[model samples]
Target: MLILAPMEGLLDHGLRTALTRVDGVDRCVSEFIRITDQLLPLRSFTRIVPELLRGSRTPSGVPVRPQLLGSDPACLADNAARLAELQPAGIDLNFGCPAKTVNRHRGGVVLMDEPELMQAIVAAVRRAVPAHIAVSAKMRLGIDDERRALECAQALEAGGASELAVHARTKAQGYRPPAYWESIATVRQGVRLPVIANGDIWTVEDALRCRAVTGCSALMLGRGLVRRPALARAIRWHDAGRPMADADVDPCVAALPWPQVLPLLAEFWQDVCGRVERRHRAGRLKQWLNHLRHAYPEAQQAFDALRASNEPEAIAAWLLQHQELAALAARAPEVEMTA
Candidate 1:
């Protein structure tokens, strides 16, 4: 199974609506909602994941489970119990975040040092939510050591996590290269629940090696999916022994000449413009375009063209009006959703 990782500041409701139209992404986790002290009002959850009102599914019908990030076990449970009233598809606890600020606040990966405490939090959340609601967690191997990776995974499982997605890196590594897939195998051995391997899986080959090493039935995609939008589909196609490139494949991922990625970027910009304030629209657009360049090399220049503009309309107009872009859009094949 393919799962979209909960990427902060990137995969908001709008972008998720667009990306879910693509096949192979089974479900997505909502960007973590910071629960500092009290239970946020209904408006807060709605603002973070508007799709909750729409059956907790993105526009294209993929499920989006809300992820809660906080350190207070009782407070998290209190908020999670309240969130349960909204009937989210699932509740995901966040213990994998590596941000310095989050750690200083005693919230994310810092809790890795206390396996029992991590288990206590998961148990609290599980007890608060109804049994029908699936409760899960996302975590790194450990703060600075892999020695407790197995212990932590087992703790979460014992604490009632139905599933665990391990980022395969120590908190200290902080998203460095060479994800420890071998450690994932060790983790898998200790946990009875399904374990999803996550970290640095950028291609079909990388995924194959991950599954082989960890023997995990599932893999989570983050920046890699942004780089190669069709990485999930490609992996599925590879698994089914189907040809990689058929007619109507994602042009950006296929490495086609003059692949039309600008439309996707334009769609992203339009969504952000609608949901975000005018002041923040341009920055979000630029950030997304910059990331897309990792997979579509041509995006660098496109992003460069907009370095000076902060107005949403002007930035969107630039892509829609440029002669080369206009030509590409004219020739671009209409998007056909793959079943």
Candidate 2:
């Protein structure tokens, strides 16, 4: 199955709606919920993975694995047990997030440097969740060195992880420089569980090349899919030797303009309402616009226009006047749903 990597601020409902129709994404993992203390309420778990509470699936019917992030083995296991009640497609342990807040908390990639701790956390979580629900993990090569990749993979597998997804950069790399696909090959050789390669797969060629180099059977897409929603489908079509048509996203995304972007922004904000603060809501919207700008140049203009207007109407009016590109809205209103 093609997996959509859980991006903290990028793969919210609206974004997921858009990417779900792209064709090959069989599943998505919700953004990680950091478990810092024991007795984390059931409501907190549902808030991070609201879809799981609703039905253990994405709006498009794609299975969503709820990912847990933490430093304490017992706390992680406690939360995993509560999440298991939701019957998610699986439980995913996150050891790959490179965020400073997470690392400073001794969660995420910081755990990679402590293999024994990592093993204890995974083993506890595996024992807590039901045997039927798959237990998986996503990780970086190591804290900063290549030697830690295989060792970390072995540790997780020994602890009963059903599968592993390795992002090809280390904690220190933090999305910069090149992703070390060769290191993923090393991790694959060190483990018996299925290995999924992630990082730098922006296009079909990149996917093909990564598979050839790592011999990994599956893939996890992150930034690449955000930049181009149809990418997953394109990769699949390319692999099958099938001709595919491109969505003229430039025109379509531009038609809504910056003004029009507000309501859509509001839609996603509301989806996570009561779960996140207003400041966080607004920040998440801006973060998406930052990435959306890559696909539509007009997005830059719209982004600039909406810089101050957090209100929906103000943002919408700004878009109407600035959007001079072909009115893609007139031709397609449904793409927003798929996007």
Candidate 3:
């Protein structure tokens, strides 16, 4: 299955709604809610995961699991229980985030350095929540080294993590290319539960390679999905039965006309603009355009022209008038038919 990665400050509900509407996204995790020293109010969890009150699902009907980020096992367990009371699809612990601010706060990848603490956190959370509710952990291979990857995975598993998602890089790698798929393989080998492969899976081919290298059956897509929304659908199609006959650009990426994807972006902007303060809406649109540019190279030009404008209407008009983007916007949903 393809899981959407919980990208802090990016994959907000609007983006999750839009992306999940695209085929092949099985489920997604919410932006990690940081827990420091106390229990958060119920409103806090509901606000971040509004879908929790909406069946814990995006409008498209895909589950959106709530993820917690904290250092103290007791605090984590307390929050996990509170989150469970809301009936989230599942609870995910954040250990793979490499943000320096988060690490400095004694959360995320920083905890990967302490397998015992990681184990304790997961165990506490597992014991706090009901037995039927699933508990999962996401972590990078290691902090400065990969030697302890196996230990970390084993610890989480022993602590009752139903599954482990490994961002295939050391804390030091910090989202760089050439994610160590080999390290993910090591973690999978050492654990009995599912070990998902993540990091640098920018294309369908990258996903295939990751699964092959790590012997992992599942993939956690992050920026790659943001760049190419059709990616998971493409990977599923290729993995189902077809031989991966192409080795050049991913067929899915090749099939999309950049100009055909603009309207979708515009629609997402429309939905998200009302959710945030007016001053912040433009930045959000630009943020998506930045990632979309990775796959739709033509977006680079449009973003350059409108990066300074905060008006959604002006940006949408500008995007629509440009043949490069307008054409992509006007293009049909080829991914649905072909994928």
Best by TM-score: 1
- lDDT of candidate 3? 0.85
Error of 3 at 11 (Å): 1.5
What does candidate 1's lDDT look like per residue over 64-144, in tens digits?
999999988899999999888888989999999999988899888888888899899999999999999999999998998
**Any runs in candidate 1 off by more than 4 Å, and if so which?**
245-252, 255-260, 322-339
Better of 2 and 3 by lDDT: 3
Q: What do the candidate models score in CA lDDT, each in turn? A: 0.84, 0.77, 0.85
Residue 177's lDDT in candidate 3: 84
lDDT of 2 by residue, 1-339 (tens): 579999886776556655664467988888888888876777887767777765777677878888999989998899899888888899999999989888988989989889888889999999998899999999998887777888889999989999999999998888986999998998898788999999998766788899999999699988877765666776776677765344443322322234444444445545544455655555555677777687656557757867776664454455444443334654466776778
TM-score rank, highest first?
Answer: 1, 3, 2
Model 3 misplaced stretches (Cα beyond 4 Å): 241-250, 254-256, 319-339
Candidate 2 clashing pairs?
17-338, 17-339, 18-338, 18-339, 259-315, 259-316, 259-319
In terms of TM-score, how similar is model 2 to the real structure?
A: 0.83
lDDT of 1 at 85: 83
Off by over 4 Å in 2: 244-283, 304-308, 317-339
| Per-residue alpha-carbon lDDT of candidate 3 for residues 1-339, written as tens digits (9 for 90 to 100) | 899999998998889988886778898988999999999899999988899989899988999989999989999999889889899999999988888999999989888789899999999999999998899999998889887889889999999999989998888888778899998898898889998889999887788788899999899999999989888877877777755455666555654556546656766877876687888888888898898877766778768888789887787677557745455545557655666
